[model samples]
Target: MSAPYVLVLYYSRHGATRSMAQQIARGIEQAGIEARVRTVPPVSTQCEATLPAVPNEGDIYCTEADLKDCAGLALGSPTRFGNMASALKHFVDSTSGLWMSGALIGKPASVFSSTSSLHGGQETTLLSMMLPLMHHGMVIAGIPYSETALLNTQTGGTPYGATHVAGSDSNRPLDEHETTLCQAQGRHLGQLALKLQD
Candidate 1:
């Protein structure tokens, strides 16, 4: 049988959310399971005319089978007016078939997000992402106060999930606290996934 893996699925327009996805993947792998990183193409065009089947670069697009087979999921996106980007939400909406099949039922899932400003709706974005997963019957995971970084982060990091403040130009890389929270959140979800499997 293939090894169990966590799906780190994200939509990143400016690379900040992608970097958070990588950090989360590293933490998932630390739990001795595989991490599969995937991204959804933008929804600017119709389904038939959107991105090519294969991306020109970066992570490959996620398939239904990938989402169906994951033991855990880490969803990331940039904040879009107090919610996840429409592109990511559009992709999530496509997984109705999986939901009907109960493909994600009981799976451990978490969310992360990036924002251009400190108060740019990071928590609301993360919360919005969870609504779909909850409907899928996935067990939601979040960082607890024990993480310490969550306690001290003046920029981003919420019990809702890990988040980043990418600054006005969207150029600010994740600060130390945000990075730590991302990894810690991933580790928490990874451990939960393994435990649920048993």
Candidate 2:
């Protein structure tokens, strides 16, 4: 079997969430494990709308195996009315088979999100993402106070998970404190996965 890996899965509409995923993946790699980053296709309202199997740019859609076999997971999405984006929730809702088989039981998982404003439901979105992972028997993790960024960050850091306060136009990139919290949450999740596996 291949070496264990942590899956960094997310849906990014304006790239801020994608940036957070990358930082989290970096921290996962620093924990001596592979980081498999994947993205989900956007949801369509049209009943018959179809999408190409491959995306035009950025990360490809996540596969069942990628999720089922992961040693850990970091799920991210843009905030949609204080919740995760539909694209990510759509992908997550399709994991019934994994849930039935208990493929993710005891695995460590973390959630992250990006919002248009500082108070724009970042924490609620993170909590929303955690629900499905919890149903799959995952051990949810959040950034502890040990990460000083959580205490000092005026913008995005939270005990629930890492977050980015993108400006109203959604053009803001992750600031230093946000980036540090993302890395710290990823590192903690990765380490926890290793410990649980052993």
Question: Considering every candidate listed, which one attains the maximal TM-score?
Answer: 1
Candidate with top lDDT is 1
RMSD of every prediction: 1.2, 1.5
Clashing pairs in 1: none
- Candidate 2 lDDT tens digits, 1-198: 888999999999999999999999999888888899999998887541377656899887889999999999999999999999998988999899999999999999999999998899988898888999999999999999989898899899889899999999998888999999999988998899899885
Off by over 4 Å in 1: none
Poorest stretch of ten by lDDT in candidate 2? 45-54
What is model 2's C-alpha RMSD? 1.5
C-alpha lDDT of all candidate models, in order = 0.92, 0.91
- The TM-scores of all predictions, comma-separated, are 0.97, 0.96
Reference-based TM-score, model 2: 0.96
Clashes of each: 0, 0
Question: Per-residue lDDT of 1-198 in model 1, one digit per residue for the tens?
Answer: 687899999999989999999999988988878889999998775654555877888999998899999999999999999999988998899899999999999999999999999899998999989999999999999999999998899998999899999999988988999999998988888888888884
The local distance difference test score of model 1 is 0.92
